[model samples]
Target chain A: MDRRNNRRDAEGSSVITANRLLDGRIVWLAADGQWSPHIRNARVYSNVEIEDALKEQTASAQDNELVGVYGVQVSLSPTGPVPVTSRECIRAGGPSVHPDFTPEWQERPAVSPA
Target chain B: MSHAPHSSLPVGHYAYDEVDRTFLKQRVAQFRDQVERRISGALTEEEFKPLRLMNGLYLQLHAYMLRVAIPYGVLNSGQMRTLAQIAQRYDRDYGHFTTRQNIQFNWIKLEDTPDILALLADADMHALQTSGNCIRNVTADQFAGAAADEVIDPRIHAEILRQWSTLHPEFTFLPRKFKIAISGSPQDRVAARFHDIGLMARKDENGRAVFEVYVGGGLGRTPIVGVKLRDDLPEEDLIAYLEAILRVYNEFGRRDNIYKARIKILVQALGVQEFRNRVNAEFVAMDRARYRLDEKIVAAIQARFGVPDFDPAGQAAEKLIQQRKADRAFDFWVRTNTHAHKQPGYVSVTISCKPAGGIPGDVTSAQMNLLADLADQLSFGELRITHLQNVVLGHVRQDKLYALWQTLDQNGLGTANVGFISDIVACPGLDYCALANARSIPIAQKLSERFASPELQREIGPLRLNISGCINACGHHHAGHIGILGVDKRGEEAFQITLGGAADQDTVSIGQIIGAAMSEDETVDAIARIIDTYLARRTAGEQFIDTCRRLGTAPFKDAAYAPA
Candidate 1:
């Protein structure tokens, strides 16, 4: 969560993201430090808040609640936080071929702390 | 030679012994404990990722993917049934056969992996060394023992290599993942040349089995055809030679850069002759007796692969000929899907998983169940998974062929496109894979649909079109006559074309890139244009690869990049 040590060039708003450890469902860190399935509910961290959020999410990752934890570049729009890269967008939206498998389609609930 | 009676035959060909069973059981127990630790917050994700990877559990886009190794593509009916059960219980109701002769379950849960692994252990199977930078599954010709022209059963050597490489302390963490493929016949069905080590079985002047070794061939971002390291090494020295080569690679292969870590890049940088020199030096310095394989050990392993009982008289059943005359589809299926067997009144049948508009290499649980029954009834209760993403009934009786075909056709497993354009090899790209840059399944489906007509596919004749979602080359795009590589261009899916590459016989060559990358929509048109160019430029009865060789890539490149 320390931005000074991290190599990412934080040009825009960002969020900590990971796949849930149990089911590998994509999740984002909410403002309340909980893992939320909905990107719309994801806490968009800007400037100094990004570092704090990343640290909190990393600690959560260390608790074995999520796998492949990292920060994703996102831009805050009128609707929600949009992923900066197509890869991240795919991860957030689910695989292009099977929309039914997406967390949104499945109506996944936020994961409680492990 | 007189054939043995079916009643006296072994119950299971290549059945696991006590040691193998114990080893798998122990591995499952260990992994289960590791999983418990990870879940209990003792082991972090960073620490657990590699351990899970070693067990073939990968976190893909949709869910955790568990890759179960099908050793040399060989499996018994009971094992096949268990695979079906696992598909139904632990994963989605289907599994995908990979190019490396493994089965992948896409939708897996981390909590259930230990239980799933225990299930696999019941069948004497494990996901060991399927991932991570280790010696992966050792693949061989699917038609190894059954092919008429094969000089030796490559499966014995493959199994030997598997035992040698499994959990080898020194080579466990290498510069990159290593692959080894063995082919018994002159025809390169296993794509041996495109692997880290390619062993071709040959007989020397003294009429003893030996290997023609080739090294440093791979396909990822940088594709290279393997160079011959030894023309004729004694069968006993197989392990020693392999050790020497691996030791050289382990010592010098690049580890600083992930992209340049494969043995092929190392071979390229050092030059083949220099690499060979180092390997030869290593070989000479090592104590040969320690690594040299004993003839008795080889015989013991070979004995495990029990021969299928075949009818002595090499005559087709009267009913088969009659059925062929009546049903045109059956006739076509037999002509394309079945190959001549060395034994009389027997043939090897390829069960094509690539149905029209279906995802390549996908098999439902019901299909697996049906195949298990078919394998029990028609074949010798054994089936082989081919690298081309098809199943092979290696010892099906000619008399029972029609009945098998009917059952397969009913289950959507009988497509009759074995080597045709529809028999495509594609990787699970962006749809399921986390590392894929673009989607590959849709492209494969589109091509299969476009070439659905059996007559047209036959007329086009023997085209190997492989598609990869990324430069990882899991789809073996580099070896295809027409290769399509999916790349991310400006944050959108685009495909690059390659032509004039082949992976058959002894003439292994890497394809050259054709032109600029094309959008997903434009890719099919570009493929058609290249095929049309081949059709126009071909002289007489030249196959796709033959025509490409004669004219080089100029014609195909021109056609691919031609004006809209």
Candidate 2:
């Protein structure tokens, strides 16, 4: 999906994210155009491509897949894209107290559509 | 439930009339359609924010939270059962009772909310006006009908306010949210003085009901006491007088800056005397007949809430002597959690949700179900949510107290700390709230666990400790004897300490800041040190606030920041 809208304006990377409309589960824009629950599988986009990613995912939002779509600033590591701010990290991770419901913190999944 | 399937309205609770039921049904259907539209590609989620807020659906950090209004903190077993079912089915297994006499389920789905709301409507409850910049829930004394010192029942008046403010078109979009609290008793158990509009019920020279109205008193970043707008506004003119004040605020309250938007800011900007003059002028020009609170209407509402039949010759506290002697734990629980009732042989029992290290204001569905059954069996099937984030089972017979205590003790509900130091009120904070700068529950848990001893709490006497995640002061930190405010200090969570605040009937003062903010651990230690200072300085039978006021916060502040 990123190949179709491959445009990079800056070196810095970010991921498009939103909460699913029905249950409000946090999801990230996967490389295959699906909103994946795990953030590690999201396709990281550059500043210019963020707009394309948002426009592409807006169809999903229009189709009632997810809502409140926005780009979260992230840092690219060998593992995956990590959230930059504390609030986004908390959004990526569950509540500090309730760790049982949180996803694996350091676990990595399918790589972005490089 | 054993006796009936709720075919009859429970005693001491208001039953919905046909019009109320029909309106609720139509509102639910409309909300259902709205949710459907948002999902079916007609309206985007961003577009649905304002619409959802009117129906009490707020988007928090992780998920959506639904706040259901418990008007004046009054509900029956049937309502409690519905809340339990919703908590168990739609969201998590628990629901949080808020400081404003409402219940909130944290992890709600947007799709399931309509069903949850319909269930609430069946119980004669709704989430209407629970959110948004409108008139929020009108809180009142939890023990309104049962308090021994109550001069007038405030529930009828609160119900009247609920009816008037449900969908007032003019006031729907205020500069900011508005909160009003009413205290039925002379003792001001509901912290009426800290609300946007405070009404204290009293009788005139002829023994007819009247009120002392206080305007623009609120707690936030700028905490201020409400100014007295009227000394003795006649009961019949209650609605009219409130309209006058709200109209003045709607007209002159600042809207350009959100920080300066609360009525308190307006009241402070114009000064008390000038603001009072303007409100009085508005009152003089109002259409009198439309807003006149008819005694017949009040009587009708009062009749709907049928008075609980109390035994004239009921045995008093002497009946519990043997039982108290037998069970020491029950004795402490009774002393701390129960209060004097207007009835001769009954008492109002406070079921404190603050266990040793449990979450404040959180009750699991199982506990809710049990409490509902117990209320039906023992306490007239009525429940109340207090300002301090505890539940009240009002009007329990002295003889049946042991049975109630046993059931609560078996569950985790028997915490023997009602107004004690450990019965802390903490907001949802960063864990659930999107606006919080720090977490409040962990601090509350640490404090409650550190001060878990019943004997120590009894020794400390009465103390109100509150923590707010942000400066919004939802936890009423401004009114606590010892207050903890969570702030973002250079990206790290820090707690600010305040001393010498009290929101009771006798005293109403905002706390004074003590030095700089501290870390979470430092905050816990500072509170402990403050308590130690109080314990050392307090005279015989003097409470924490009295000691703080008598010596001022200088000594406590010194102790808090002293070498340690």
Candidate 3:
């Protein structure tokens, strides 16, 4: 089961994403379990692990830092973990219309201008 | 919250007495405490969501959005200035005027929401009833008092409705959101037919003021024009009539499925005759005295909305003609952006928010402050926010229009695109709204740029081009003469086009979807072709919708699906 999960992670992964409570900025779960603005540095979890992890975040310490926390399916691209769905991709990036309103990226780089 | 009696405010709006003022302060304090509880883990997100929503705070794509109601789209200069100050202080230097005649700050922090609400309350405004399942903000004709065609000022009824509907205990948690609109003008500028309850003010056979009440109309996944429930409901029985309709809807509306939860579905399920019968039964059985809209109460509300003192000798016709002929841009602005005023020599000037390549309904803090100053000087120190995402100086004397137009033009507020193809009503789609499937603002900008020529817009004539980011229909796509709905065509951005619909009172109808979804560029191109087809098929004096109805959709459909 572990070997199979490892093989699956090579092609695709998942990350936890939500809006920071105070400012309502989009944030991703990092390796240290801290909410970070940069999506590229988001900690990638396998499908099996993410289900349990998201449950914990959603149920416990929900109001600690974030709101609307949910798991985002991502593609294991060369540079970083990328959100798979268009909606997640938009949340990770800023509004396609307002490039000026988008936050500057850290860790790797912003993947989609859209 | 208590309704403000006719008090200090000069503007003919809902005046706030000391009691109303105190109530607002206490409400803000309570909300502040609720926010603290939410942050401190005393209230879970699940528990706190409804509370925050009740206060009109919504979590959008990037940040918290605060929707502040400009009740019936009316506000004083002081209120407008306060809105500017809030935009400058808490938000990203701008605010968006929505299709429902409310202002939305995009980048609000959750912590700052309480303070913002406090600031708004001081200006005789609140976000309450802007969201939630309860009856939302009551909309009326922007030109209610000023329109030449108006037989009555609907604001009296609108204000009464606003007070009655705000926090009504029985209807607070209805199956879905309920919207009500009132239009005094025969032209129906308010799109009254497309609301959950549409009330049109008119005279009965005896020439007494009465309401032609329409019920169960809505626009969303299911776009429907309301059915007439009462032909001439007596003016005094307005409250009782509305109460009966609400009681029936509240008890019977489906709560099982969100999509099927609207009162329209219930009305459709029961059939028109059966629905009317149910409403009539409730109307007849209710304790009529309890819900009576007393004449004294109505008179007091009507007195609060004092009419502006008109100038008989206003702008000189010859001088205005000279000014129009001198500059073509000024002439275009006058032709497209001005509406007829009841008072001669005066007109209601629409300050177009849909500028070239700018986001529709967006106004910067500087622009807001300037407009407030302009309202003070040019108009009667009052402004109206139109349902079409524009601002109206409803009582502008014709003489001041040229000067007002110039100032607006210099400040990027003057675009003479009202009722033109470029004046697109759009939603904050996937760009900001979490529920949207694709972005709408960028597409609107592209369309504006494509049809940038004032001459081309003039040639196209009056057309309502509305865009919705999703099927939720916040943008009122179904009402547009030509509508565009952005959809997710399996991970790709796509837009479905619809043709031959109008939201105006007389010609109200839903647009039919023309073809399969198109990419952003293709959608713009198709719209251009559709316009061309209309131009080609139209008679000498015919408008877009008339030509569309006559020619049918065959030519436009072919034009839309044509290879680009």
* The candidate that achieves the highest DockQ relative to the unseen native structure: 3
Ranked candidates (lDDT, high to low): 3, 2, 1
For model 1, what is the alpha-carbon lDDT of residue B238? 94
lDDT, candidates in the order shown: 0.84, 0.85, 0.85
Writing each residue's lDDT as its tens digit, candidate 2 over B150-185 gives 998888889889889989988999999999998878
Query: Residue by residue across A15-57, what tens digits does model 2's lDDT show?
Result: 9888788877778888887778788899888876688767767
Rank the candidate models, highest TM-score first. 3, 1, 2
Per-residue lDDT of B1-564 in model 1, one digit per residue for the tens? 222325533332456788989988988889999998988888877788899999999999768999999989888777788889888877767899999889999888899899889988988888997999999999998887888888888888898999899999989999999999999887778777788999999877876679889898889988888888998989989999999999999999999999999999989999999999999999999999999898888888777776776665455656678889999999999999998887777888999999998899999888988888888777777889999999998887787888888888888988989888889999999888888888999889888998899998888898998999999989999999989999987557899998877897567788888888988768888888888888888889899999999898997888887889
Pairs in steric clash, model 1 = A1-A55
Give per-model CA RMSD: 4.0, 5.5, 5.2
Off by over 4 Å in 2: A1-14, A31-33, A43-60, A74-85, A103-114, B1-7, B312-316, B562-564
How much is the lDDT of residue B291 in candidate 3? 82
lDDT of 2 at B329: 92
State what share of the real interface contacts each candidate retains.
0.48, 0.47, 0.68
DockQ of 3: 0.36
Off by over 4 Å in 1: A1-15, A31-33, A45-51, A74-84, A104-114, B1-13, B313-318
Query: Judged by DockQ cut-offs, is candidate 1 incorrect, acceptable, medium or high?
Result: acceptable
Isolated chain A: TM-score per model? Answer: 0.75, 0.76, 0.75
Best by TM-score: 3
